[model samples]
Structure formats: C-alpha cells, structure tokens
Target: PSLATLNIPTVWFNNPNVSYSKANLGEELLKFEIPRYTEWVRSTEAGSFHCDDTGLICEVKEAVTLTYYFDSWPKLLEEQNTEELHVAGPLLNFKVDAAEAVASICIPHFLCLEGEDSSHVYIAHFVEGEMRLEKPDRVEPHHAVLENPKFSSLGVVFKKWFKQKINTVVLLYHRLHLETPTFHLYLLPNDPSIIKVTRNLHLWYSRLPGSFA
Candidate 1:
C-alpha cells in the first residue's frame, strides 16, 4: 500500500551497521540468546537479570556496533542523517546523556553478523509481534523541507500503544542509542497495552555449539 494510508507513525530506526548485512528472523532471535551463559559486560546491578534482561542487552549491543565493526560508518551516517532524513517523522530525538552509542549498536549487530559473510544492509527486523503497536488512522505525508534536505520527502502517522489490563510498562531496554549510529524506539504514547503483549512474548535463543547437522 502507498505509505499515505496507514494510520500509524512511521518510526524510522536507522542502523548504519557498515557490514551491509540484513538479519534473518532466526538470527535476530539468537542475539537475544547469547548473554545468558556469560558476563559480557559489567551489569548495572549485581544481581540476576529479569527474565528478559539478557535479551534486552543483546539488542542494546546490536544498536551500538556500526562504529566499531564497520569502522565508524554510523558516525558518518548520523552526520549525513543530520541532513538526509530529518524530514522523517519522529526522528531520532536521542537525549543528550543518551544519544546512540557504540555499545547499544553491538547487541543487535552481533545477532545479525557474527561469522556470517557480512555483506548486506543490516536492516533491523521490526518485531511485528513484539512491538505491541498499531496504526489506527490513515497515513499522511510529513513535511520536512524546512528541517533539512535529508528529510524532504518523508512522513508518517502517529497513534498510541493501547495499554489496558496492563499495570506496568517494564520494557527490557529503555534506551538503545549508538553514536557510531542512532538506534531508535518510538511509540504512539497511547497504546501501552500492545507494549505489555510484546513484553510478555519476547524470547532469546541458545545455539548449541556445533555445526548444524
């Protein structure tokens, strides 16, 4: 369908993972699977992680790696994005203390790369099931001409993540920022209900150490 009829915001998450690798759905799930068996980094609290903490951190690292593995491609893209896709709705409005960083990009990147050939656009898979969001209105073209040349022909719709029968919004990864890149997470603000559904469904995978039979 033309992007002009969806009643949901087009949350754009750019992953400049210089490797040019797009992750397969199975591979994406693997990144969430890795951390359970080891201590990759120092944890914020010295206690056991919540059920999905390991998965959350994996996504965090994937969000931070383009700078390192791709040799600072995300840095360059962020600089370009400052000009190229600014007209896009809900651009990466990262916080000063928390703009996208290398660490955040690594989690998701690793899930997609590892020892693979690593030569394709590393597109982040929008977990349609896990995102717990929906579009309730028709799509509309966004105007970004005054913002920047990078955003001239872009637009999106905004709605909410309906939060009902849901009492808490315990998203595993609150922030996924990467300076080497910009990892984004957007919501309709009204659909918190979908958030809980995805939260309840998130999972990680563990690869048995061996070549597949």
Candidate 2:
C-alpha cells in the first residue's frame, strides 16, 4: 500500500485485537475495514489517535510518574561479601564482582523494562564477552512475544516507575585490598516466595570460601 493511502494508525499494528490474517479473509474486506476505521478516527478526533499523512499516531497519557537516581558506592568495596542493595525503585545494584589477586571493580547500571513488572537484567561476563538481556533459557524472547503476554497491574506500576527513572551507568574500577570477583544482576519477582529464595541464596553464597571481598 502506498504511504498516501495508508490511513491506518501506527498503534493498530500493535493491537492484538486487530487482525492481519489476510489469508483467512478476502482483500475486499480489509480494503473496506481499513478505510472505515481510518475515517471513523478522523471524524471523531479521538484522544488516542492523531491523523497524519502517513497514518495515525497514538498519544497515551500516563497517570502518576515516579523518578529515581543512581550513585556508585565506593565504600561498599570494604564489605566482606557481595550483597544486593536497593539503590532506588528502578535503579538497583545488580551485582559486584571483584578479586583480591588483581583488583576489585564494581559496575552499576539500571535494568531496562520491557513492560510493566517484567524487565531485563544485564549480566556482564568479561571472560565470555557475551553480555545481553536476560531471559528464560528455554524461551526465546522473539518467540515469547508472539504468545499472549500475562499482564499484571503491579507490573504496570513497576514499568511506569522504571520509565520515569534516571538511567545512568557508573563503571567504577577500583583496585581494592579485597577479592577480585565479577558482579551480575538477578531478576526476581516481588513475591514472598522469591524474597525468601533471595535470602537463602545470600546465606548460601556467604558460606562459600572466599566468595566475598
């Protein structure tokens, strides 16, 4: 379709309710429906849709907005073991890796949110040089998106918090008298069980010989 005739809004492309099953339906039906939907929005001047030459643009107004800031903790290097601390709502200490043999360095960053509640944690493994967004090993992110997403109101709230947060990366490489270990981020749900699991993992790591700085 020509750009001039593409009167459809861009938001419609993402809406699951709208069907793009051309094989199931005839072109004539699509030809009729597209223009009809386009005309309806243009005539009504809906709040979500704005008519332009290319197509429609959706302007979704948000409700409450929260913000957060990030600061690197240099004094934390003196601590015996690595522990996750809540820096802010969106910005957090994902991980801190260090070694006593060489130098203990800490990298800080904020995870990117894909949707409400659901966000990605960036794990940095210098030995492998294969750093990317974290996801379930079995589920490919591209394929997972094709399936229906389980939306949560709590997730939406978290998503908004992340969207409004200050995104900054503080890479502080310091040679400490402590251990040289690597740090990484762990994504856990805001559930009671997960909280318990995190505590247990902390205890387990503490028991490991020379696990802490």
Candidate 3:
C-alpha cells in the first residue's frame, strides 16, 4: 500500500486513557480502584486524540485526582518507615518533627498523578495560570498522570494563596507512596505543624546504597 500524503503537519490520534497493561505491579494497578466510601475521580489517559484536525475538538475524558490519608503527623508516620518515603508524597527534608512534615507536604503539596486519561494534563493548568502550552508541567504534569504517582497535587488555595508565602512553615508527609488515583484542585494545610518539608529525598537515595543512583 502506498502511503498517501497526510493533511496536517502532524497526525495525532489521541484516545484518552490508552490502556498499556504489561508485566508489572504498576500495570495491574492501572485498573485498580481505591476503596473509599467517598467520591473519587476516574483513572484514564489521553491517547492519539489530537487537535491536529484543525477544528475545535472537544471530548469528555476522566480526570485523575488525589485524596490523602493521615491528615496529621502521628497518623501519617504511623504507617511509614524510612524505605517508604520515596514512594510517598513529594520529597521533603522533615528531620525537624515528624508531625511538621504531615502538615506541609501532605496537607498542602503537589504530587504528580497518573492513569489512562492524562495526555494534556497541562491543558488545564495553562488555562488556569493564564500560561500557554510552554509550561505544562507547572499545572497538569504528565509525570503525575503516568502510573502509580509518587506525589500529590497541590490544592487551589495553596496555588493562589500560600505559594508566594516566604516564611510559610512547611511539613513533610509521605508514607507508602504506593499510588492512588484522585483528581480536582486541592487545598493546603490551614493549620500549622512542627516540621518543614525540604529534601527528605536525599536520605531515601542515600539508603539505596552506592548503586541505585
């Protein structure tokens, strides 16, 4: 078959939540659902669906949001060990007080999300920040919507309010960052804690020995 001339400069076939189940626990978790009695956003992806067609292509797709557990310190650290930090919430250096880490990172932090329907995660952010396509990661990062996300998405209040706060006391909260699918804007901790989430990731890597990095 002879290849015909394509219309647009690029032909993108986007199908949100393009299934890619393969050999691993991550793959299995793609279809896994968190057992919460409350509401939950669906897991999905953005596939070959592209606006390259030249017209306004509007379609409905699932959004990946997150809901955190252990809203407090003792609650969070209760289930965690040193090895579980990397896989938990965003990396932070919370050597101050375990409780401080919980208020800052978990209560008010941004973790990347994943699933099938995360093609243009930036699309949403661009519109919100009044930014353009150049800064996608700032808002809807693909890393978050990939699979078994390790971080959490910061809330709207935190985005607009506390973001510019210079002396805002922060916390660190990441137990077993196994991965859970949740969506929508989030909120930061309204209360103060005793820790600051700086670079807990270093300790995690250091424990990996002299070979992991």
Query: By summed lDDT, which 10 consecutive residues of candidate 3 come out lowest?
Result: 7-16
**RMSD (CA, Å), each prediction:** 20.9, 27.8, 23.0
Q: Of 2 and 3, which scores higher on lDDT?
A: 2
Whole-model lDDT per candidate: 0.21, 0.22, 0.22
Off by over 4 Å in 3: 1-37, 47-70, 78-107, 110-148, 151-213
Candidate 1's C-alpha runs over 4 A off are: 1-104, 109-115, 121-213
Tens-place lDDT digits, model 3, residues 85-202: 2211121111111121121111122223332232322211112223222212332321222211123212111122111211122323333333552221212222111121112222
Q: How close is candidate 1 to the true structure, as a TM-score?
A: 0.17
Quick one: ranking by TM-score, best first? 2, 1, 3
List, residue by residue over 1-213, the lDDT tens digit for candidate 1: 111222332211223232121212322422221111212332342232222322222123222211111111233234232221111122121111222222221111111112332222122112211211222121111111111111011122122122111111223322223334322232322222223223322322112332121
Ten-residue region with minimum lDDT total, candidate 1: 144-153
